[model samples]
Target: MSTTRSRYTQTRSSTISDDQIADLIYKLQQLIPDDQIHTTTLHHHKALNTKVLEETCNYVRRLQREVEDLSQRLSELLQSMDNNSPEAAIIRTLLMSP
Candidate 1:
């Protein structure tokens, strides 16, 4: 007889929750109307959706630029610290250590 064991110990759960689905459904309902729910209206909806998505992407890009600027400023400030300062010495030691 042979004994078998599983190597995997954990299971992954879905990233999307019920609340997210409900919210998406609500947004879709708000975007679509019963009278305008025909195939002919799809193009109009698609254009509006594209516009909104583009705006969101632009906003995200702006935020990313701001974050990058702040990070660069922080790095410059850290680099400006005196090498003999306690904080700078600790940082240098940590960087040199394995």
Candidate 2:
């Protein structure tokens, strides 16, 4: 019975894998000075990676929500149209006319 439309938008953006981020972090660690590199730096990289992953997951969830909302709306519309309705009769006549 809910008619509120979903505001979610589908994004076709590609996501990077955690393994790839790990590889990049490993490579970055090798580039930094041994003395400058510490646990904090690794932690920061991990935090940033987690943030990106969460964003991607949220984006997917939003898209799914939008799809589900649209599907529900379509189902509601179809349910409202019985065979005796004018629109339904028109649709039937159109199909049979051809």
Among the numbered candidates, top lDDT falls to 2
Per-residue alpha-carbon lDDT of candidate 1 for residues 1-98, written as tens digits (9 for 90 to 100): 00000101111122334466456655764665656556888778767765775566566556655655554554455568885798866755653477
Give the alpha carbon lDDT tens digit for every residue of 7-73 in model 2: 1111112334557656655665456554554766877766665676657666766776576666555
User: Scored by Cα lDDT, where does model 1 land?
Assistant: 0.53
RMSD, one per candidate, in order: 14.5, 11.5
Residue 81, candidate 2: how far off, in angstroms?
3.0
Give the residue spans of candidate 1 off by over 4 A. Answer: 1-37, 83-98
Q: What is the model-wide C-alpha lDDT for candidate 2? A: 0.54
